[model samples]
Target: MSNISQLCVILGDQLSADISSLKMANKQECLVLLAELQDEASYVKHHKKKIVLVLSAMRHFAQTLQAQGWQVRYVTLDDPQNTHNFTDEVARAVAEVKVDEVLVTQAGEYRLQQQIDSWQSSLGCTVRCLQDDRFFASIDDFAHWADGRKQLRMEYFYRTMRQKHNILMEAEHPVGGQWNYDHDNRKPPDKSVPIPPPLRFAPDQITSEVISLVASRFADHFGDIDPFFMAVTSEQAEQVLQHFITERLVNFGQYQDAMLTDEPFMFHAHIGFYLNCGLLSPVEAVRQAERAYMEAGAPLNAVEGFIRQILGWREYVRGLYWYHMPDYKSLNFLSATHDLPAFFWNGNTDMHCLSQSIGQTQKYAYAHHIQRLMVIGNFALLTGLSPEQVNEWYLIVYADAYEWVELPNVSGMVLYADGGIMASKPYAAGGSYIDRMSDYCRSCRYKVKLKTGDDACPFNYLYWYFLDKNSELLANNPRMGMMYRTWAKMSDDRKYEIRNSANKFLRNMS
Candidate 1:
């Protein structure tokens, strides 16, 4: 028996050079496995950029390891002998290589977690799941902090993280004698502000081949297929980080809430894919932003807010996903059952906010945070689409979406499906919210000020209907109760008109 000593499995996303799992890799002793199976890509109608980026990055990472004298067994998507499934592929590799030990970091999805358990029994081998130390705040560490908290707020968690990491701190206290400066970061871009051009890397032959493969194989998927960006390598991802800290981070905290016409990226840092796909480690990314605050005259709000996202919220969501797996994906507090509108796939809509947010996603496989939560997620919630269906749209559409991140954001925080685990209540509202935060509503065909007329913005009607329908589920929420009182004081005639206008808006092709 060959008794292959180690089975080193690399999932598509873990392509980092300094990953802890790669520490024990050896040429003759370990067998490495890489698979591009249908079950993984087809689970959600994957964005075109997502498919190309992952495949190209995986191919590049495998070549680097092989060049360094490691034995790699790469299984391509169209491998004639490929199983096209994760469990079957793991079994096949173990039997062929005669491996007795399986070594890997914990996976990023719940389905994969279950799959690994059964795979172990079939292989009759010892499987060791190492901690995914890429994140500064581990799941164990968060659990320790959440032990006695009555309500888990991101701000509170963010402050704790500031002290634990000693980031932005000054001699046992915060640098500016305060934990946050969010008020300082909300200025709109002005005459002096010119948006910096986004960082673009020239595509190498390796990434070009991956784009060609995705175009050929996944042409049926909805999204723009041409003008694919080359984000497949770690070096390019680091360059994107440097550019943001220097040219954009100062304005990032301010217009982080603003959106403009034809300007898809604005001051947003487009590194979610790189962070999620293992091209950039969380610590270094956070450190770079902090250094900018110390040395490069970046504002406190810009530095602290950017750092909180990575250290506080990103880690919080991942912990929540693991703490309530398999079940978290099924939450539906409002019990919505409507199909997603056809316009979501094609971005063919008169609603300027949705068009910009959803269309930009198809074009770039990216959206800034406010665009996602306020525009798209808000529309889905106000219109009564099922949270599960809404969650699936986000999972399929973004290059950075893994189950661990997507589920909590959609099902918990954005949708309020877990009732209160991720958020206190549904973030339901009208186009007025969009109008205040962005430029999208200004150019929309539907009148943002109208609530019950032919020219009424659909969000006005949907907001009332959503409140009426889910009143029983949400009336007592402390934050929402005041809104309920306001709705109760409205005349019956106006309420009737609003609901009627909402129904007509939903029914009409207009």
Candidate 2:
């Protein structure tokens, strides 16, 4: 067995059998190491389901490795000897196994990657962090692509990725004459449209045990642990992909940006939990959507928009995260410093949209994109919630959140905290946008049409208030100029009323 030639460290996120660290590992010589670390599970108070998902997937992956004849050393969270962090575990493994080298897939988080990079010299053994090949773009590849670009726009980067990967392409041209179908994909949810609940999986013994462990250990965590139905293995994740393509993909684009009172899923493929965990490959997911379009006659708009998310926005965000992290996480362009309202965690609010979105998040650890952007995120931006607080809340609440993906989306796109890296302007909206796009306003306790009264929806006045208060920082922005002009043209009395209402709400927000 070459006297423990290598110790292969598999992280919770790096569960794929085809992960780079495993590609050259031999069953006879390599020892696979999987540990449930308290440090990771407790970092930022992850959603209960997220913890269960990762631990269950790690256990199943370890079992899969053993079935393939690889020598596996698995450490449960409750292991009496568990030191509760990666570095200590790795140190113990190297000493006990007498391995000459360590092999690991590059960690998704920058902090973890820095630690892995430090291991070789510290451990006195050769440590290799193989490039994570699950992504279509390598870190270096994205860096090279991003070199010297004046503005890092997703649309341009996405187009380049399409050409490089030859995805949805015909010869040298894109399959469609145009690059984006986003305009066509913004239709409000059709109440007449019958939305199927996403496919659910009953927990097996492995997952059931994980649920118990997470529940008892993380009882104070942000989200609910019971009624757990997420796919914890690649096989089950594939079933989710199949369900999305066959049943929901056709209408996914049409209702992609829509939200409703009780409809959280709304034709949105809830497969991000799978995709971010390495259970589903981004390339394979997009290719399936493309195939569905060509073979099953799915609309081009639906297929293109779905493909754009995985191929375009997902890849673009990851690249941006790696390109400007550590610094990126701290950017707060507008100096937003208000504490996040407690209602975010407990969902105790009179606003119907916030109540529904936050309630669903607590229950399922999922919310569709628009609900995230226009509801929770928009409210955060308009109300001047601290970027760090808002960013951490997003990281804490979602099952699919890892720092790389969650940081960019929250700090850049959601809050415009990176100044304009992910967006030209902050996605600041009022109740009108929510009312038009969702059914939440129809039944809201706050009247959507009232702009300044006690019964007025907070969003109605908050939207105008944000524009006026941030005029110094945002007025010169070309995209924001029109809103500034509208604010400029408003009667002084009306403006005073709006600003006063917003200030009153802000002062009382807790």
How much is 450 displaced in model 1, in angstroms? 1.5
Write the residue-wise lDDT of candidate 1 on 1-510 in tens digits.
263588888888788877766775554788888898888988787998898889889998889888887788899988899999987888898888777688777787878878876766777888877778888777788888787888777777788888888898887898878777778766544535788989886668988887888888888876775677656778888988889899899888877777786777888888889999899888998999999999887888888878888888898888778777778888787787778888988889999889988888899888888888878888888777788788889999988989899889988777788888878778888888888777777789999998878888888888988888889988999989888998999999989998898888777632
- Give the candidate number with the greatest lDDT: 2
- All models: lDDT? 0.83, 0.90
Record all residue pairs in model 2 with backbone atoms less than 3 Å apart, i.e. clashing.
none
List ranges where model 2 is wrong by over 4 Å: none
Instruction: Give per-residue lDDT, candidate 2, residue 249.
Output: 92
Worst 10 residues of 1 by lDDT: 184-193
- Please give the lDDT score at residue 45 for candidate 1: 79
What root-mean-square deviation over C-alphas does model 1 reach?
Answer: 1.9
For model 2, where is the 10-residue window of minimal lDDT? 1-10
